[model samples]
Target: MSVTDKDRDILTRTLWGEARGEGLAGQIAVGWTIRNRVDDGKANSWWGESYAGVCQRPYQFSCWNKSDPNYAYLSGAKPIPPREFAQAQIAADQVMAGMVQDPTRGATHYYATSMPKPPVWVKGAKETLRLGHHIFFSDVP
Candidate 1:
């Protein structure tokens, strides 16, 4: 489907409770915002491996996690600390918050790029929440 159609579908799903309030569209918007920030090739704009590459596409940066070892490896550094991860989360949250009407139900996750393990809180909310590898958010109020 076209990008416009995909966005419409995502919005519909969110409104109808078929998807979370911070669903695919929110992710896409966040990613797009990050891409714009890093597209200038500024050294400090590097967030992770997924975002290290040029953002020719819009949603490429949304799934990136600076906390991941892979990102660190790519950037020639050790894994990011909790503070850095929190900063990244805040940045992502800021981007997503502007695109989405609701912020209470919006959440983002940062994962270890090289590790195979999932996020720590996945099991707890799996039954009631729509979970993804790097992020979790709810549609219910």
Candidate 2:
């Protein structure tokens, strides 16, 4: 699950409101975010550098490679396929969903889609979960 500079650049560039509004951008953002968080130490919280620091759970799990003593707990095996990546995305989405508010405050909610309109409030946080499954899990190219 080693992340590269390209991955970070892609996530940072694509995870913005404009890119997120577009479904494809949103999907890639989510995927790239998950991968970067795991490989690097980036946090995906709404506040980039607020009290909420970057999440490190993914990094902890990614520490284990096939040769590492704790590899089993880190991940099942090498080269986690797209399906597995999607599963991780879903799990991350579930966690993120819990953090979102229905009538979100200005600072509490963050948009991930790149739709043409202004920042559209997420109708339902579950949309992220569905997106995770569809983009990361499905075999769509």
lDDT of 2 by residue, 19-137 (tens): 22334434443434343334333455432331112222222212223454434433333443455344444433432343322221111223322335423334433322334222222
lDDT of 1 by residue, 9-35 (tens): 222221222112244543443344333
In model 2, the Cα lDDT at residue 138 comes to 15
Q: What is the TM-score of each candidate against the true structure?
A: 0.23, 0.22
Model 2, residue 30: what's the lDDT?
A: 49
lDDT of each: 0.35, 0.33
Scored against the true structure, residue 129 in model 2 reaches a CA lDDT of 30
Error of 1 at 9 (Å): 29
